[model samples]
Target chain A: MAAALTRRRFLGCGGVLLVGACTGGTGPAAPTSSAPPPPPDPLLALLEEREGLLAAYEATGTAHPDLIGRVQPLQSQTAEHVTALRLALALPTATSTSSAGSSSTPASKGGSTSGPAVPADPAAALAELRSAVQASGSAAESVCVSTTAERAPLVGSLAAASACHALMLS
Target chain B: MDPTDALQEALAAEHAVIWGYGVVGAAAADNILDRVRAAEQVHRARRSDTAARLHEAGAAPVEPEAAYELPFDVVDPPTALQLAVELESGCAAAWRYVLGQTDDAELRGVALAALTACAVQATRWRRTAGISPATVAFPGQ
Candidate 1:
């Protein structure tokens, strides 16, 4: 829908805000920034988006029980991801460079610790989930799935799950 | 499939879900209207977050057109659920494609989230339509 596309366009305007390392020192943009040049670190963006995903899930209601059950545990993992990123970001030592020539710093030290916990209102939860699912599915990057060996089945499993969701709704 | 590539495919599927829900949600009854709205929000949120992630990753996220072609006609909630089921299934496939290509532990977590969401949607649709949800996990797999 026109309204839907516009919503993203509105958000895109904030792309500039997602810049720079936590340190004041000058450097390339963060890896999460849309700019073609690799940013200082991608872990920050991952943390922000992970929160968004959890928020959406909390909004989803009972319409998607299967989805909620499956993802509830992973929500905790995403929180852990934020913690790991923050730790990585705080490391006094420099990180090794990826083969792609990109730097591999961890997430900013201030990443969130909140998991996607909420009251058990299946309907409300499903609504939240619908949003989270969209956000999660729409994200298309390799920051986390860096190696080729671990990538394929992850994508396949995601796809199959999506297909299964479609069949039930249809 | 590459991680970015997989995410793109899943994004496309999300695009379709967002598009199709208009008709399906509209037709759903009052009892389930809230559910319909929630699903719509899911699609919207997903679309936005996905695009942001895409941009963050330096990939231009595909813009959903002003309109999208639906897989089938939506006449009622049952029909809507039917369409939703189909859409969810397609989304599952797209996410699966992402699962296939992704390896990074973090990205893998995202792919798993996607997988779980789609499967839940599919199961919901099946129950809505009085269809059986197969006990075996990841039916296509």
Candidate 2:
């Protein structure tokens, strides 16, 4: 949980890069400096988190076929979230990458891998999902506090959805 | 875009929701009436507080409509629950707009709480309506 909170802290503090509209400049651009720009925007990071969640849903569903009926809809909704986030960020949707190459990691740990390992046990998989949803929701709310007003509601809704998902999983 | 504008909109939504719940409770079975009453009370309190906030800010909050257009006929328990879901969803959307209009932590906190409550209420109503998943990717998108 601490790690997850830290990830949220990173997202909230590093959100200025997401919109890139705050640059005040009436004069010519300054000479390029050696200093690197801020790391990738946390909005992108949240999108990647959603991607990982989609993978988790798919993997868990595949591992437990009996749960497919309940899992497919969630997978579809998570896909929609990723699409919406991508559109909000003005990024083109990319084709699915290599899931096989991805590794299982909790969202709080910030693993770039897409695949999140699901426990073979159905109950345990649900537990994992609850935790992930809670963490992702927290991350979304953190981003909400820093983004533009137009975009904050988008993230806020994501957080609410995450909370709802956690309830369903429970 | 001002907070008052959003607050007024939220107050309007709360009014509609409180009015809608009256019809909803009438159509709901005995077991569901408790839930309806609870929801109505919550919205009513919220409406009062919102109006107070608006008045404090020197903005005149809009009055509730004499009646709101029902999305559908509330003829049974299922329909009542569905109406409840719609009403809460409306509240969620309105509060979300409020969130977009303010950066003040106190106001933001209020908006966030209201939005979250409405979303959760929608989920509960969906469950009562026998909707699977009972949740959405976005509540007010």
Give me the candidate number with maximum DockQ: 2
Model 1, B87-133: lDDT tens digits are 77777667656655645577666665665576776677667777654
lDDT of 1 by residue, A71-120 (tens): 55444444443344456456333322111112211232343423345446
What are the chain A TM-scores of the candidates, in order? 0.33, 0.71
State the TM-score for model 2.
0.82
TM-score of every candidate: 0.47, 0.82
Q: What fraction of correct interface contacts does each candidate retain?
A: 0.44, 0.67
Candidate 2 chain B lDDT trough over 10 residues, lowest sum: B103-112
Q: lDDT per residue, candidate 2, B1-141, as tens digits?
A: 468888989999999999999999889989888888998999999999999999999998899999889998899888988899999999999999988998776787688778888998899889888898788888876
Q: DockQ of each model against the real complex? A: 0.18, 0.55
lDDT of 2 by residue, A53-92 (tens): 8878888888899988877777788888988988987877
